[model samples]
Target: MTATPHLNTEHPKHNLTGFIIFLCSESVIFLAFFSGFALLKTAALNWLPPGVEGLEWRTPLLNTVVLISSSGTIWLAERCMSKGNLMGFRAFWLLTMALGAYFLYGQAVEWSGLQFGFTSGVFGGTFYLLTGFHGLHVATGVFLMGLMLVKSFIPQNYAGGEQGVQATSLFWHFVDVIWIILFVLLYVWQRS
Candidate 1:
């Protein structure tokens, strides 16, 4: 059997040391945003939007389940990739993408139903800022997952699927984790 070319090539799968550093920097940025949010949250005591009372948690909560389930599917996809089961990897990856789409759709519906727009007040602004950035990250995860699916089909990109899957999973998990904090801060902890 001819030896396959190095899958990671110049990327992190071949050398994750640098990838960890990149992840750390990303952590720093998000931490700063979270800190700013904490500071602003106190100022919301008087100005907090009452429209939040009308917010429906069911749909958003369901979306949270979608993300958590997608994380599971990603683990299976990684398993399939390790077994060199390309079709299995592709299928699970598609399921994960679909779940991600469902989560975004839920977000759109939730936002549409909100009485306050993004600029309505400090609450609206920060709410959008936190969730909007999270949505962007989810969008990026979808694209990255799609990239892995495409690469899975191309024999040339075969070796890198594992790396792609792991990186995508990392981003996905981070998105979920951030949302957990966001949910607590917005829905539970910060309640007046």
Candidate 2:
């Protein structure tokens, strides 16, 4: 008689739960910033303040488009992964990463040309606080996606374990949704 070893296949619910809790906490921080901005804007004589009139909507609009499109790519990647189409998954994931990088680059360019600092005034302070934090989240999402991409290349790493990809897709979509709200608040609402 031979003794056989058994594989442990316990499914832990901690990963998804932990991620949801993290998102909830992050949303609280963002809500605080939003409330502060609303209060400050309501009290200010002018929204953008002096020397900041050159803030054009075109660049931010373009970045928004890029970011939104990345959300779609991520969806496709997740679909491919679910279907076990590794090639399609990798291609869409890479495209998603490139779009995220492009969006971040556009943000850097726009920030460089701005005449305001984080402490410039209420307008600048709130603007930088919100957008900077959001940019950091986007960078984090991109970094996580890159890690997943690399893991996918290894046969033993991501084999039959695509939960990371789904988690990453959720995070990317969250970042995109946040940016859309911020864009409307910072650009469109500010103009009205």
Candidate 3:
């Protein structure tokens, strides 16, 4: 008689822990860039490059609103998922992805109108490095959410995928939080 091997069906805690650690590492990278920008701003007499005036506020502010709103939508999606409401989860998840996409589009449009390039100087280099890195994260979050949404269509997948949804939500929230800081630093603080 052959013995059957036991499989652990419970959700593993290490997956979430590993993801948190990864986020912490990412946080350190962002902090380094922020610190560099602050140091440069304080040391330099001319913060903005020669031809550039100051960053325009309107579009970026609107983008910030959209990106921040995504945090709420993703939260609702996670809540719905925990309660086993798949339809509600799908709706909110879709909304979150849409908001992320809109923010990315707004950022690209703003970049297109900029007077300076990444090679301009310290301000330009830091500005593109910070925003571009954050934008990459935003794009990643959106892509992950897209995969999650597709997997959600299968009923069996829904029950097994809660951890994935939570991880994606956490990542999305991190992206949103980072954007809030970047918006204040790049747009608001530079002006004053």
Q: TM-score of every model? A: 0.86, 0.89, 0.92
Per-residue lDDT of model 3, residues 62-98, tens digit only: 9999998999999999999899899999999999999
**Model 3 regions lying over 4 Å from their true place:** 1-12
Which number leads on TM-score? Answer: 3
**Count of clashing residue pairs in every prediction:** 0, 0, 0
Report the poorest 10 consecutive residues by lDDT, candidate 3: 1-10
Query: Each candidate's lDDT (Cα)?
Result: 0.79, 0.87, 0.91
Against the true structure, candidate 2 has what lDDT? 0.87
- The sequence of per-residue lDDT tens digits that candidate 2 reaches over residues 1-192 is 354444354464467767777887888888888888888888778777676674679999999999999999999998898888889999999999999999999999999988889988788888889999999999999999999999998886656556677788988999999999899889888652
The predictions' CA RMSDs to the true structure, in order, are 5.0, 4.6, 3.4
Candidate 1's C-alpha runs over 4 A off are 1-15, 50-54
Extract clashing residue pairs from model 1. none
Q: Estimate the overall C-alpha local distance difference test score of candidate 3.
A: 0.91
Q: How displaced is residue 46 in candidate 1, in Å?
A: 1.4
Ten-residue segment with the worst summed lDDT in candidate 1?
7-16
Which of the two, 2 or 3, has more TM-score? Answer: 3
